[model samples]
Every structure is written in structure tokens, then in C-alpha cells.
Target: MTDVTTPGTPVSAAQLEREADITRRVLESFDGCADPRLRQVLQSLVRHLHAFVREVRLTEREWDTGIEFLTRTGHITDERRQEFILLSDVLGASMQTVAVNNEAYGDATEATVFGPFFVENSPEIAQGGDLSFGAAGQPCWVEGTVTDTAGKPVPGARIEVWEADEDGFYDTQYGDERVAARAHLFTDAEGRYRFWGLTPTPYPIPHDGPVGGLLEATGRSPMRASHLHFMVSAPALRTLVTHIFVSGDELLDSDSVFGVRESLVKDFHEQPPGTPAPDGRDLGDRSWSRVRFDIVLAPGGS
Candidate 1:
């Protein structure tokens, strides 16, 4: 009988390959688990992640740095701030996702990212109430109607509106007392609604996290054009989350989130000073900026 001798602790190229194969096999074990959708998602993620590591020939130092960056991103988040959303904004992921899901349904209003600054449960204000909270900037009157695709008014739709101040900062960023710029309004029987607010001005997104680092590395500015954010919904129609951008904003072409759509841009015309108040409220000599937009909603099951 012949006896074969093996090293006391063998660590050959073949052994290394076997170890790597075992690790991959253990991870891939979940590929056939229950819930086909979960399996599909996880499998795809694993495949792509592994491919990325190989494609980039990623080093341990790079991986550690990435983990640290993500940790810091979480560290900077709070009730009024979200560094992760800012990261997605700088990467254009938010806009890309919105555009992908906002396909036209017979001229329905275009949808845009909701952004990270929206505060739930804003004060409800009657139509024509000044949303400006007395802040000074371009005087703008925003009026619009919620309508079905057939041009019929869809009354009783809820419209939640918010926008940056004249200087392009949100009320939350300023203080709770500045909540005047945010309001919720429901359309009347005529499907019409209006509000008074300052024309939005281009403002920079928060630039103090990983997102800021990315923007700086890419030579891209963090400014978003002046615009009003809207979230509108009706019982039988698709909810629309969008923005109305002031035409001719200097940063329109370079919006940090890539959210500027040509169709969403409208001119803010200056109404004559000393104009009579249609609602009989005392509006002083301030020049009012006016813009009118109509929303078309998709029919049920659309």
C-alpha cells in the first residue's frame, strides 16, 4: 500500500479558490428562498454588488472610506434635516426616480421630487390667503384649478403648498414663526384655488455633508431655482407631487436635483401696484406677481 503525505496546514492557490467559492455559495443560498420577488431583488443586488467590486477592483481602504462616509451621513440627520436625501439629490437619483414614474396620462401635470423640507400638517389657509408671511421679495399670486383630463373641474381636491422664502430659505430652516409660507387648501366647488406668496428665488441646498462633498468634487453648484412645491390628491385620481418654477430663474438650467421641467416653468408677471383687492383685503402698494396653472388629472384606474 502506498501512503500519501499532506502538509500539516495546507494553504494553496486551489485552497484559496475553494474558500472564496464557499463564501459566494453561502451568500447565494438566499437566491432560491421563498417569496420570488424578494429573491429576485436580493439576487440582483448581490450580483451587481459583486460585479461592482470586481469592475472597480475596489480596495479595502476605499471600502472603509465609503462606510465611514455613510456613517457620517446618518450622523448629521435630524427632524428638520436629512443628509441622505441631500445625497440622492446631488446624485440626481431623486429626479430620475420621479421622472420614471411620472409618465404622461393625457396631459396630466408633470411630477417632481417632493424634496426633503416638507413639513406635514401645515396650517390650512383659505383661498387667497397670503402664504408669504409678510416676507419681502417678488410679489407673486399663484392661482390654479384642479381639473380632470376632460377639462372638467374636480372640486374638493386637497392641495398642500409650500415654498421657500424670498431669499430661498424654507420656514423650517428659518424658524417655526416663519411657517407663514406653508399652507394647505382645498378646492371649492368650482375647482379653483389661489394663494398669495413671494416668487421663489434660487437657493442652495444644504451643503454640509457627503452630498456637499460630491457637488464640490464635480464643480456643480447646489442651487435650486425658485419654485412652489405642491402635493395634490383627489379620491379618484392619481396624486401629483410637483413644482411650478418661476420662468427665467438664473439657476433653472442648473437645478441641483435636475428637477426643472420646461413645461413647469411659467412667467411671473408683475401686476400693477395699488391694484384693487378682489377679495377686499387690504393689499398695500406692493407689486404682485401673478401666475396661473391648471392641473389635469387622470381618470379612475388610470
Candidate 2:
């Protein structure tokens, strides 16, 4: 008889014992993987995946459905949209990864999810310039300071800002506009930056696709709280990607992406009509809001 102990050879086992042996063999087969780190990660992933399958006693049909779902998610992803990222955000994986990667020391700004809406090569704008392109919403003045953890200013830090209008629709949502309500600016010598933006409002995640279907099936809401997104960067400091949520928004307690942190919540003071803006520009006769968000960055390579 052929040797049964050899790799790839048949072996006899009770049905209950087969799964355990298979797990062991699959892990052992990676012993010669050249990259040690890759081996370690793949081994761990295999263990967890196998454990999950066993715990759920996953059915064949369920497995096939999952494969098909992932296939569709990949198919829908393109330059302007990312369905896979939406799936990860809803599943909490994206936030968890951010938390693991960003452990700021002292009063450094906390990091949050880089949502699917971010676009590269945003138009550079001057301080206090309006970012909205006639989008519907009450204009708001946003001013902020950028500093190191030691409380020293970080001048010339690049600040990229973007947000949805009152209607909960981003400029990218409309095909006519290439860019709106999003721009980049640099901090002044005092580490201060300002811009005119819209008061963020609650909006639903794109729910016309597979990720949306998953949310609905799981009895989850897809509403994200009102918030302003920021990506601030400076020399010798870690780039910070985060958000400042509008205080008192109904969905703040239950942001669909779980991106909110207590430290990131901020109050937007409502100013009466004709209140002067931060850059000495007149607000005319319309009401506006003001918010101050100061950021502290951790040293680079931390």
C-alpha cells in the first residue's frame, strides 16, 4: 500500500476529526513560504476564516452567495466610486484599521475613516474662500489652528477640506460639476486656517448597490451624521485624516460608518444675519455659522 503519511496522500479519519486535521495541514503547508510576514498573516487569516466557517456551519449555497456578492462589489468599483470601501466602512473594519494605525500621543488629533467620497487633486483655494459652488445650504465660516503635540504651531501645513451641502449631496454626486465644496489650503505662520463652507447635514450612504442591500438585510440604517472631513499634513508630522462632527445632529449617536469619536464632536455657533466672516469679508444679510477646529499632529514615523 502507498504511504499514507506523505503530503497530498489520502488519510483515514472520522468525519468529526477531519476538519481539525485539515486546519493543521493547511497551516503546516505554508512552512516554506519565503516571506515570513506573509506566511504569518496568511496562516492567521486561514485559521480565523476556518474558525468562522465552522462556528456558523456555513452552507454551500451561502458560500456561493458570498462569492457572488464580492464579485459584484468589485464590478461596481471604479475611479469615482468604491463599493468595496463602503462595505468595509459599514462592517467597521475601516475604522478598526484606522484606530490601530493612529495612536496619537498627548492632545494630538484623533484619526477617523477616510470615506469613499475623497477625491485627489482638489483645487487649491485661498484662506476664507468659499468652497461651495452654489450648492444649497447656509454658508458657514470654519477657522482652525494646526499645531504639534507640544502646542507649537505647524506653519504651512496643508489642509484639505470637503463636505456635503444641506441637502446631503456632495458636489461629486452631480455629474455637471467636476469639483465643489472641496478644496485645499495651507496654514499661515500662526498655524491658523479658515474657509467658507456649508453647514453639514445628514445624508444616506449610496444605497443603490450591494453594500446598501447588505445594510437593509441586516436591519441597519445608512445615515451618516453631519460632519466636515479634513486631511491635514505637515513636515515632520504624521498626516491626519479625520472629521469634526456637527454637535446635536440626530445621527451623531449612530453614524452609519461608526466614524464619530467624542473628541471630534464640535459645536457650530449660529450667527445672526450680516455677521462678519473670519477674513473680514461681509456676510451680507444672510445668516451664517462659525466653528473652530484646532488640530495637533503627532511627529512623523511615530
Candidate 3:
């Protein structure tokens, strides 16, 4: 047999092995996309995805299983639950996105994953009010200040807060009528805020779905460290989405969603029985814990 080949032509065997060519071709397909940003993102995604497939030499069966897993994840997602976000959280993608986009300025609060449980229009709460209605947990007092990078108070800052009960469940996880352990409040003129709630406790990410299956198959724990979630916003400062972790939590080093950072860990002081609360509420004999999570908002945006 006679071979017909050109000097600049790629040979069939070599062409098949040049995996990067596949990525290039996929990227080229989006060249006509009207949105430059979307085109750029898709191109990068294709490159990374192809690189990943090549790195692992992914087999047909593995690819099919991944597709099936994603399909199932979507099937299980709805208004109440978000399996895709849960998957991203478990894979560390959500936290990485936050880190890339929310670089702190001066002493502005660091950002973390927004988790899947935040609700719109949470009931407005007054300072010193309790958020632990119909929820079971150790009593806790949270006080904080919203400030600028220069330490000036940002009065009237809106703070949206949520967290699991001591038994590791959010208000959303219950079907009951009453809401618990979550509320939205505003800072006082001095930029100080306070509320009463349950002490945070470590809990598992929902482990009954596809993401959970992936965790079990990969030998990873689904446990998140004890923490309180906060989203703080002011007129001219960037909105901050973050969490304050329990300082001594066992899972701080192994949060299932990789959301823990050293700076976000805070001490939850155990108040002795019959002590006067910071808000001057008199409790007869009930022990309580207190955490002060002051926040500094980045300047600009919303």
C-alpha cells in the first residue's frame, strides 16, 4: 500500500492522541457566541473539562455514570432543596468560587459558601430578640458590629442570619408551621447587632441523594463544622456572605463543604448559670453561650 501524506498534515494515530486538539476544537465552536463573557467562560470550561477527562483517561462507563448521577441530582432538586449546589459544595467548587470573587479588602469580612438553606423574607427580628422558636438547642447570645474597613460603624446594616439547631437541623428541614433559628435584623445606630439563638453544632450535609452517594463511594465524610451563617449588606459596601465557625469544633478541619477558614473561627463563650446577659436580659438559671462576630464590609457595590 502506498502512503499519501503531506508534510504539514497530522498523522491519524498522533492526531487521536493529541487530546488538547479536542479542547481547541470545542473552544472554536463557540467563536460566534454573541456574549463575550459567556463565550470565554464556556471556552475555559471546555478546556478544563477536556483536560480533566484526559488526565483521568475517563472510560465510557464512568462518563455514563457521571451523567446519570447529575440527572438524578437534578431530579431531586427543587425550591426546597438544591442538590446541584450541594454537589458543588461537596466538590469544593462553591467555596473556591467565593474565594475567587470575594477577596477581602483591608479587614473586610472573608466570604464563604452561602449554603442551600437561606430563605427569602425571613421574619424581621429586633435586637436582643430570640430566634430559637420551636427549636431545641443550648441558649446562645450573638452580638456584633457592622463596620467599614476603617472601623467606622455602618448603622442600619441589614443582617440575614441562619443556622442549624443543636441537633443538626435547619428550620427549612422541618415541615412544621413555626420557623426557628433564623431571622433578618438590622444594626443599631452604633453598628452593633445582637440576637439570641441556639449554639451551632456539627451536622451532616444531606446524605440521602446522589451527592451523598458520591461521598460514600469516595470515602469522604458529609459532616460540616458547627457555624452560624450571616449575610450582611449596607448601602455602599459590598454585601458579605460568611459564616463564623465554632472555635473548637471537631469538624473544623474537615468541613464537608470545605467552608471553614482559620479567620472565621470564633470562640463561643459558655456563660455560667444565672449570669446577666450582655443585652441585660435576666435569666434565672439557664446556662447560655455568647459569640461576638463583628463584620467589616468591603467598600462599593450594593
RMSD of each: 7.2, 5.5, 4.7
Question: If scored against the real structure, what TM-score would every candidate get?
Answer: 0.86, 0.92, 0.92
Ranking by TM-score: 3, 2, 1
lDDT of 3 at 243: 96
Model 1 clashing residue pairs (backbone): 139-289
Give the least accurate 10-residue stretch of model 1, judged by summed lDDT.
Answer: 1-10
Which lDDT tens digits does candidate 2 get at residues 34-87?
Answer: 999999999999899987776566689999999999999999888777899999
The better candidate by TM-score, 1 or 2, is 2
* CA displacement after TM-score superposition, residue 75 of candidate 3 (Å): 0.9
Residue 209's lDDT within candidate 2 is: 91
| Per-residue C-alpha lDDT of model 1 across residues 87-140, encoded as one tens digit per residue | 887788898888787778888888888899888898888888876666657667
Name the regions of candidate 2 deviating beyond 4 angstroms.
1-13
lDDT of 2: 0.88
Candidate 3, residues 167-235: lDDT per residue as tens digits?
Answer: 898987776556788999999999999999888999998999999999999999999999999999999
Residue 44 CA displacement from its true place in model 2, Å: 1.2
Worst 10 residues of 3 by lDDT: 1-10
